[model samples]
Target: MEPVKFNYEYSRKIRVGFIGCGAHAFRNVYPTFDYAPVDLVAVCDLNQERADIYKKRFGAEKAYTDYKEMLKREDLDAVFVVLNFDRNGHPLYPKIVPDILKAGIPAWIEKPVAYTAKEAEDLVELEEKTGQFVLVSNKRYFYPSFEKAKLILESDPFGKPVSVSGRYPLTLSPFQEELGKRTNLHWFLDICHPMSGIHYLMGEVKEMCFIEHQPSGNVQTLLSFKSGAVGNLELPSTQADTSPFERYEIIGNKQNVLIDNGMRLSYYKGSKGSGEYGKAPSYIGDDPTDGPVHWEPEFSLGQIYNKNLFLQGMVQSVNHFSNAVLNGRKIERATLKDSLHLTKIFEAYKNNRSGKWITIE
Candidate 1:
């Protein structure tokens, strides 16, 4: 791994303006600037007090009650938006990002970029027209475990991933009336975390079928990937909050990889039986090198990896956008195009009932 540079160590930094002085921004996004190449020049929010507080707290040069005024006055290379849902429970990104694009400033916005795929399509069109890109902050794609998993999947040993299983504690309202309204989809929109990781690891879903449980409202979604792999997504809504909430496994040819609780990963490369199946002396295999490879964070050390900012991928995603803006690199992760795919999944769940195979295209 390359050594990480602190913000001051960079030879240059992008002039960044921030919109939305919310709690998530304060806790997750703003702290990332300490490690990213960002010079936070200005902040904006509808709440004047919050904006002023954020500017002072985060070391921004100026604060504004209106984001448009900030864009108008500040010479910014990129902007970070971390807005919350409006009263209607709809994300504010699709409504706001077009104006930022028109201003010729790249944007890094928090996800569920839009309530529908159509809104995402509009953003894609606007990005093409304005020549400014938007990177949705879907941090699941940047998670350290998933990053390592990608390398393992691409290696020669783990040949042809054939199936996937994922679990996340997210509840979906089964009623068609509730699904139709974005206001009612707050939980579904904000809490659908596993889909992004699944997309990153397994590629796009060609078709999907889901079955809902009655009292619990839990769901199990079956996916057929365009790559010819199959998948099962388990959204066990009634799972206890205190319990380990998420787990994932990708099965390849005679080899399988598992991610537990989004942090621990185990790769079970094809293991040979101890001697023969009937009369084995021990369960342990003969070759030490053939044992399953395992990885988990060491909490004792005061290292960057242990920090939630790095662990949960907030800093990595921020650095990715900042570097892309600074170097004019084409962003491969969490692009608007990726957002379109995720939005299609959202639309599929909302529009169709359980047990039906919905085609995604």
Candidate 2:
């Protein structure tokens, strides 16, 4: 991939439209334009007051309560959508996205991409029919630390990536199936983080097994990958809110890398030689290549890497979709395809109980 270019450095900027003037877009998405190659032409939301506020705050020229009207009136290269749950606990994007594509504009939508794999498949089919693609902005997969982890896993020093593991704070009750997808919405949506990360890092999952804790509703899943790699996913709803919410590790042949809370990264190159654990004079390696190389953000500085927009991957995801639209290339990150895979993982959890190995075909 090419080094990223700042907004000012782009010779021509894409004229873009935005939907959803919610807390998430306000805090994360809208602020990313300072680093992305786009000129916001309009903002749209169901609430005209909120839409007008976003338009003024973000320097967009116009605002509208109806996105359909916005799409019809504005000549846009692409649209960025950030709406979350609907009244029924459904995601609004799937309902609105086909309309956007029907209008001939490409889109970048936030996850959860759809309520199930079937819905995602429908969206993909519409995307192909309209000749317009949608990028889901899965967020976690675009994190700088996690992006580098993918690179490391694909390289030689690690031999081959054999397994991956991730942890998140989420509650999924077995009775969610009884309540169906809408009432158990958060469980279906939040699983996107771990599922997207694993799919992006290790390729497709072939099959998986799960077990849940009765008290906390925490669940652990074991995944076998099509690539011959395996993975573990932990959903610990009782985990402390004071600490970081997510962590990950991938074990390569004789090496492994760990990521904590999307910031700290550690690459453990196994001990230089398999000597007795207690007999070594010093743990320091004789060669720098024998590495447990590490990385983490330094908040004291004003670096871009330290900002939440960068650290959480909002800016990077925006820039990526913008570049794809501007360059006439298909967007790969968080594509409808990735969303489909993630929805399958969601379905597996909803459909199966402890000890069942559900194959993802």
Candidate 3:
């Protein structure tokens, strides 16, 4: 297959400013500008020295120690906020996003939008008032495999989705108070990683029942979607050290899909013919395409597919955001409304007790 083409000159280059100069942005975010329609004009961080270093490294023209000052001086079309969490592990996006919106600039914030549901909702309300866009960087939904899964679910080939199973190694505390205290911190920080894919594959969840295993600090959640599809989430924190971090499977009427370790993908459309007891001449003779469509990048070549943008879903996500801002198009995924739903899910896991079902609708 040919590499997907992205037109870097799609629109008049957007004058972009960055708010965080942390390691993640340095490694994953700023490098994406190479393929996107962005003119990085300025960057700001609390540390002037680090900001200056990024400005020089990423070819930005200006750098500042304060975001407010940078916003006032720079003529920016958009800003990317990759700031770290507070002492409580609560993401600082809610506090910074309002200021960016008030400054009349669209913003793309890193995941786990805020520490609490209320904080997330506040940002939603602010977007409505300011008429500016604020998107969370939920990269899993931007992945090619998950993107294909979404299209398959919507297409008639899969009929209708019946159920889904997601596996992620995340630690959950059984104690209610401990969970609440950790709500805005470690728990919410990672929930967006899996929940983003869930909301994208299946629409808004209507109700959910979860059971927590105390001994191993694992959680099993059963979710019923508004589309009458049921799903399960397995958050096992006790997996082997060498195992991958995540896995997912979605079952439909006649077809099923699985994404393993965020890279390998398989689609099972059922067997073509029944096999004999012992005289099956060729097991591969059933069907050519229906067998299993597997996908994983070959790292032999120095290609963009091997880069973090393609692997971490950063390129497509940033491209999508840029296109929406440039063309006045509505975003299909990672909108504020989607973030709101995800925030509620994180809160439910934090506040609700095991075996107590919660309604998110």
Candidate 4:
């Protein structure tokens, strides 16, 4: 589908309610309303003061301390759910999402989806039963650079992706022995960034073999995808603070694409060359299409792409969910499949017993 220009004044907006008036929403989710086609109808939070503040700040007509109360009182097309962690480092969505579905309201939620794969699977069952759609806010999958790379890989010349590699700067908390006291909770939160992009590009992981760094507990994992593609995830806990947080590359035969710092993308349009490698004159390519194509947003301009909404993918993601509801379309970008895949990977880390190979069923 072709991209539609956002115009709140000219276009109709979806009547939506928001839950969790917290810092994350204030910084990332709520600001996107300026560009998205959404009419903020109500705001809900545990704190009446925070809910009222958010209502006034974001143009919501009503404020409710109870989301169930908000759902009952307001006629909403969809709801945006953003909340902090629980005592177990698990997000509240696993419990709250079912309520939204039961009330016949669709949701756009943030990660991590749940503490375990079982919880995500249970949510999926509820989603299927309720027939209410959920669009997860996995922003990395919507990043402009990665989106372009995905298009390049899917088309000709690139063919099918055969292998993948991702580098993210994060640490695994020390392994805990207590059962169900998973020490990889923070890892689950951080892995969402890289896994969102990888799962969007590659299909799913069949299983993985992980290795660890002694002192820092940093890990490097080899992920085997069900699509027969292999991948490596490099988690560098000791990486310098000033260094870029992410680097990714995927190979498809001779064609490949590389993403740097989540901002720059280099797509190599590889094909059979005209001349021999050693016998060729200059290394410069005569064919423009066969060479590498690069893309990165220009920050100097006062453009929407320059802002965090577009830059960090918060805007496009919200726009995507809003478009699904407004256009009466099926939402596919952020689904329960991603939640399941990510949970399996998180579990794999928790099950990193001696760095041996582990199959994710």
Best by TM-score: 1
Q: Which RMSD values do the candidates have, in order?
A: 1.6, 2.0, 2.6, 2.2
Cα displacement (angstroms), candidate 2, residue 361, comes to: 2.2
Tens digits of lDDT, candidate 4, 241-337: 8999899999997888999999999987644445786887656577756688788888887888888778778888888888888888768787877
Give the Å error, residue 131, model 3. Answer: 1.2
Off by over 4 Å in 2: 176-183, 270-278
lDDT of 1 at 345: 94
- For model 2, the local distance difference test gives 0.85
lDDT of 4 at 257: 94
Please give the lDDT score at residue 279 for candidate 4. 80
Q: Which one wins by TM-score: 1 or 2? A: 1
Ranking by lDDT: 1, 2, 4, 3
TM-score per prediction, in order, is 0.97, 0.94, 0.93, 0.93
- Quick one: best lDDT, which candidate? 1
Per-residue lDDT value at 72 in model 4: 89
Q: Candidate 4: where is the Cα deviation over 4 Å?
A: 1-4, 177-184, 270-281
lDDT of 1 by residue, 1-361 (tens): 2236899899989999999999999899999999989999999999999899999999999999988988999999999999888898888898899989999999999998998899999999999999889899898889999999988887888998899999988777755555453236777885437889999899999999999886677899999999999999999989888989899999998889898999999999746557766888766568767879899999998899999999899899998899989998767799999889999998888777788899999
Least accurate stretch of 10 residues (summed lDDT) in model 2?
176-185
Better of 1 and 4 by lDDT: 1
Off by over 4 Å in 3: 1-11, 177-188, 275-285
> Which ranges in model 1 have alpha carbons more than 4 Å from their true place?
1-3, 177-183
